[model samples]
Target: MPDPSLMEQLRADLTTARKDRDKLRTTTLSTFLSEVKNREIEQGRAVSDDDVRGLLTTAIKRRREASEQMRAGSRAELAEKEDQEAALLQAYLPPALGEDEVVAMIRDAVAGGASDVGGVMKAVMPHTRGRFDGKELNRLVREALAG
Candidate 1:
């Protein structure tokens, strides 16, 4: 009747991946699940969906960096595999904000008197954190302040 939590969704998808014999999906989901479990154990409390989203974002970032490194090292096959894993992890994240949407948010932040880069970033990061790249957000905020 209700949508499952991210943790629950990952667990269910992990089971499905196992059943479907999708090794990449199975491995990715299991590693992500293990990170979620580790955090819960470390904190002695269950993570909220936001916490899971943070983990997903971190995992995806790691995968993307690894992909880049592999590509630079000329390991084409490994790079391709890492890219695949990154794409797989990307699916679990909330859809990214478009340029227009981000610009609108930046405008609102600036209008709210976050006229400096640091101020604008502090104002907007909470809203954009897991769904947006910090570098891109910072650039947008700078653009808003300038124009």
Candidate 2:
């Protein structure tokens, strides 16, 4: 059987959240679904699962940044809210690779003749994309190349 689209999954989850009276989850999922719909309208077509994943990734990143800024400003309550929202959004993302796993992948790329940082990143990104943070991967690649 074909996989259900990401939007369908999100809508199903939204319904469940509403039924459970999970206000935070219901709000987050609804807002995200609206964003996805807007993007679809812009493109005049249904977006792929990858596109939905990208949108989720962006939302999570924004929440993380806002959480950090709020913490820095000593607003613990607001920071906590952002953290919760980010966690909710992250539930839809693919699990991230561990540091050791990422390091191993970088080593393999370097061994495969990716000598410079840029070359290693280019080699590793395709394997790591959506499963790892680019900044963390870049740092690991640099350390692997330098060592």
Candidate 3:
């Protein structure tokens, strides 16, 4: 059989998590699924894999921030739970590009006539979006231009 789409895979995993009574995984999946549903309704169409990935990325970022805040507040247990949820959701994203790989891409863009940060970013963002964090990618692009 053909592989299921990311949405289908996520739903199937949610079912499995529920069956196994894995509380963390179940809560993470349920919350993500709701976000997916909300995005679908907002856009008035089914989400593509890329759209789903974006939503997953946003959810993971939120969890990361919450985890940090919890830690700062001395809620280690809550912080740990947030970290766990973030890690669980992170599994659904595409593998992140390595630093060297992203640098090579930046070099190529620069060599191809992108002399400024804005231009280099415009050239590279399409290829790297969702694969790397925006701030890190910007730093790489700026470093490339500055070098």
Candidate 1 lDDT over residue span 33-99, tens digit each: 8999999999999999999989888888888888889889998899888788878888888888888
lDDT per residue, candidate 3, 1-147, as tens digits?
A: 998999999999999999999988898899899999999999999999999988888888899999999999999999999999988888888888898989999999889998899998998887877778889999988888777
Off by over 4 Å in 2: none
lDDT of each: 0.87, 0.87, 0.90
- Model 1 spans > 4 angstroms off: none
Task: Write the residue-wise lDDT of candidate 2 on 1-147 in tens digits.
Answer: 887887788999999999999998999899889999999999999999888988998888898999999999999999999899989888887788789898988888878888899898998887777678888888888788778
Whole-model lDDT, model 1: 0.87
* TM-score of each model, in listed order: 0.94, 0.88, 0.95
Clashing pairs in 2: none
Report clashes for each candidate as comma-separated counts: 0, 0, 0
Instruction: Please give the lDDT score at residue 37 for candidate 3.
Output: 95
